[model samples]
Target: MKKVTVTALSVVIGVGLLAGCTTKNESSDPAAAGNASNGTKPKVVTITVRENTWGARKDNFIEAQKRLNEDLKAKNVQVNIDWWPGIDDDELVLQATAGKVADVFMNSSVDIGWERDGGLIRDIDWVKDSSVFKGVPDSYTNIMKYDGHYYGVIQDMDASPVFISRKALTGLGWTGEQIDGLKDRVDKGDFIFSDLVNLADDAKKKKLVKMGFAVEDKRFEGWNYAFGFYNYDADQNKMVLSPKVKDVYAFWSDSVKRGVISEGIGDIDTDKAAPMFVKGEIFAEFARTEFYQMMREANGMKDDIEGYNKWFKDNVVWIPVPSAEKGGKPASYSNPAMIFVGSKVDDEKMPYVQQLIEHVMDPDLQINHTIASGKLPVTPAAQEDARFKAMDFYKDHAYLVSFTRTRPAHPDYATFVQGFTLGVDAILTKGKSSEEAYELFKKEVKQNVPADHVIIQ
Candidate 1:
């Protein structure tokens, strides 16, 4: 049997594509197996990656990919992402399961479940040198583990999610007093989905703001935060994953019907939504921390940018969806995107992979990228990275790591995800009640799907 050890009881997130997962043992060519035959190390290796959320078309990610490619080329290795554009998470899951393409897939959550069915392109579970992970904290590994083996490495290590809303609040004539009132209501647990439903409709009719909430519609943030509605059933020891997941669907559907939540959001992709929010029509949104910088860049030529800054002078607030009910901290789940090595590559290159991991692992690298991307650092040490140190959002949102989560740790998590989505559709589009959605969710899970365990690595 391969040697394995529980280094410590690391914190885990109970949400998204990366809940609890497992990976096959890592084999080092000429090292773990004691082969060491090649006098010269393998100079070329191809790595698979997911394009950044904005995709490589964005200058920042494109530049990083360029740098990585150049770095690898200098050493005789070539790294390329099995670039999949215009693809969503569900599609990625299907692709991974079919083993159709991608030797390494990073930036996917559903891939965790596929690992149970022998879907992984490579397994780095047996990585032994602690030095490779030195200075890197336990939190960053959330996306890399499958049953305690490191399978994926992160390309960009941002962990913070930011607040997004529009400058419309400024035009609404609501001074700071009105803003504080809303937050006070939110804090008092007086705000409920029903209430938000009303707010959305009222906003549309009264023009309080455009779209009371910027529905992310994307599975990662907007869709997932909806789960926080009923996510706090701690007796069950896990956040609920059924469609009945905390009235998320019903709330949105009703809000949509009432003209509060935009039906267009259902079709809105990140490409469209980000710009929509930045246009200052959205009341509030869930964003990565870089939103302000994006705003600053937008302001480069006009005083309206100053107006935009004033509107959010203290207003762009970050709020996690309430847990299980309307108040208290909700059981939030989080999963940062990740980088996975390719199975097609031989073990001889594992050392090189480790080197890359180390290079990105530097405190400076982690902090700079975190700031560049407006994300939280995964490492506890990186938490204090100058980026966070300098930002009030960081100091104020101290609860982010302390309270949020990742997907569950299980091989059959994909089925749960599928079922969860079904529940969401039923709730939002089908007018299903919470009870009804939960029943449909449970039925989907109980049906003949993959068991909740992955036997293959």
Candidate 2:
């Protein structure tokens, strides 16, 4: 692993300064050295960084940027962050292709594959030798690789579990013990996917909630959770579309028919759905662990965990999505946020960008960020950090890491997700049957993904 020592960093900074000064002839560039020797500040190399607000705690990024600037101050360089924050994926791609992107950016783990394939991001092959990343788990690092080349560094790990509102469940006359038992049953696969629909239907019929069940309005999320009932062949890197997908679609269609799910759910967005969940309008939805803070604030707990617990108790349940059948495996996804370097960064500025990444990847910073932001740590060392271990939230949900499975990091993964989303939209809005939707999905995948990259089951 490449170790970035104080001496080595100093030399690298010195070389950058010297390189900045040299123009035509070294001796003739007296003004450059004179400015440095006479205490005039050298030119500042401002490295812009753009990060998405989705699943991010903005304050953590701001704090990391401040720390990076503080470390670079001694080297007479500065990092100016041009924070363009939003969850618009298409906007990011447009900026990257137009060479208007920041030097470094944050993106979803799934984007690493196609972005690298499209030449929008640079391959950090040298990261394999970096001591700074040695403590990070391979599970996190491997997701950032495409065709054996590392393209990004994981920023954080989070589990997306199906969150059931405790208040709504209690309103439905569910006892505390019954709510606890529900989670246990789900974990044991005794409570299956069909059972979830039945419960939601019952809740709706009893007027316990306006909407008995809800998934994220996002197309990819909807498809991902629906298809998660099936198995992914990790050995073959193929997605096996389970025969149960037909049943899954039928379950949702029936839910819609019974008024268990929202009528205009196809048009619902996360912003609209989040508030509904907070207001007790929805009984259940799929959300990441990072979203707990939003719920806390909505309930007026405002960083008061104890207060939130007292108000809600065990009313809210966090469990893996139930299996399609009894005794079958339940599913959960670990979607890690990652940082990538833009392909547009010049060779001369690359070292500074690397230095900034090193500063951000510091063990202390990682631990602090995890504690402050409620995002999981990427490295085992950070997870074991004394400060991180002290958080009550981390202690309670840490076991989720063991069961989480990440989607395959294939170069054509983005195409598959898009096709899957389109198929799901057709089923929900166009009155298509599961068989018809799946056939259309297969056709779209075949057309969009390269033959060499396609993995059929």
Candidate 3:
């Protein structure tokens, strides 16, 4: 859910090294060689976009603008984005809501999801007639829909969240069985907290794994999403937090007892967790393909990444988190970023918004996007990109992105997740019982989730 800059992070990791290292866009440099080569600034449109928090600079904005400028130039339009990532996301959201911020902001669909309920955001569906929006899908349109209205544009769609073995599944004792065969024994297609205990015991006997499993029980994701539990049933209007809540905590604790998983699993975010896998301690973990690095960077593990790929060329299997019931489909969730347009702006600005969103949907852009960011693409054809075809991570495990359920679209979503995580962490760390933590969290959520709103079953 971080509205991060792939470009800045790219620079952080030294990706896509821009051709020349020119200091600036002076007439003397070739990196800026294309600056004066284009047509007159098509009205020099100034569009404000939030800056990325990852050390991204105004010049980085200039660079993205430079590329976007080129794209705009091709279509004979002039434009600019005001990059503005800050240290505080909530404060920025407040600023934007108060009309003191940028024109466009990158946030989980919750922004427009809130907007869709009323004047929260403008309905931009009227712009579909614009040439910029030729082939985008209705699925993309559905993301912006709320209460029968479409108000935002969805930029990217990743797979529902998934848990992965740091190594392969066979390492967890799935040997001699096909993926489908392995799928049957796990109740309801769900792998419960207890199943992992037995598996870990088996692995220990075989010296196959260091721990049973890893659980970020309090992760914004893992908290509300532990399988075997029923979340808010909007239609039913009942709260059943404990269905899988106890096991969520139990899974972490038992994993801790088994000693197969990392003790500090849930303490840190992906940045820290990834390294544990790199250290070759944990057998598997949950993450998107973008994190294959942690495993690739194992100490003294050479560029065997190229070699690993050649070997698993078509064997990297992706699977969902096991559910509590055997034969039950495991569910994973992914937060989506919604693209919104300012309703207060004149009708003329509508086309511009369409152009921006449409540009996002551009086939070439999506191809490069999937290549640059390990996030899954919503466009089916985009998956055929040579870059995607070359990636080993997606070879067999590709469908991990196919089964995702969209995250809730409420303004309080983030805070609710934060509260849930803290409560769960207390259950895992402070020895607070799950019932105690869940009770505290339920009260907090009831106070916040609105009286009329429903919590899923």
Best prediction by lDDT: 2
lDDT of 3 at 385: 71
RMSD, every candidate, angstroms: 10.7, 9.2, 8.3
Question: Can you tell me which runs of candidate 2 are displaced by over 4 Å?
Answer: 1-46, 51-101, 129-138, 171-174, 219-244, 303-305, 344-352, 367-374, 385-391, 406-415, 446-453
Assess every candidate by TM-score. Answer: 0.62, 0.74, 0.70
Clashing pairs in 2: 1-129, 2-129, 166-315, 166-316
Question: Per-residue lDDT for 1-457 in model 1, tens only?
Answer: 0111122222231123232122222212222222124434434444444344442222333344445545554344444333444345444444444433344445554254344344445667644354545455454454566654667655443223434342344454556666545545554666543554454455567675666665334443334454443332323323244334545655655565666655355565444556665565665554444455555555452345446556555446555444335664443345465656655556775655555555555555566665556555555555666656766655455455554555553444545556667765665676666677667766776673443321111
In terms of TM-score, the best-performing candidate is: 2
Cα lDDT computed for each candidate against the true fold:
0.49, 0.64, 0.50
lDDT of 2 by residue, 359-415 (tens): 677667777666566677766666778876776566566566655666665555556
Residue-pair clashes per prediction, in order, are 30, 4, 35
Comparing 1 and 3 on TM-score, the stronger one: 3
Lowest lDDT sum, 10 consecutive residues, model 2, at 1-10
Who is ahead in lDDT, 1 or 2? 2
lDDT of 3 at 375: 57
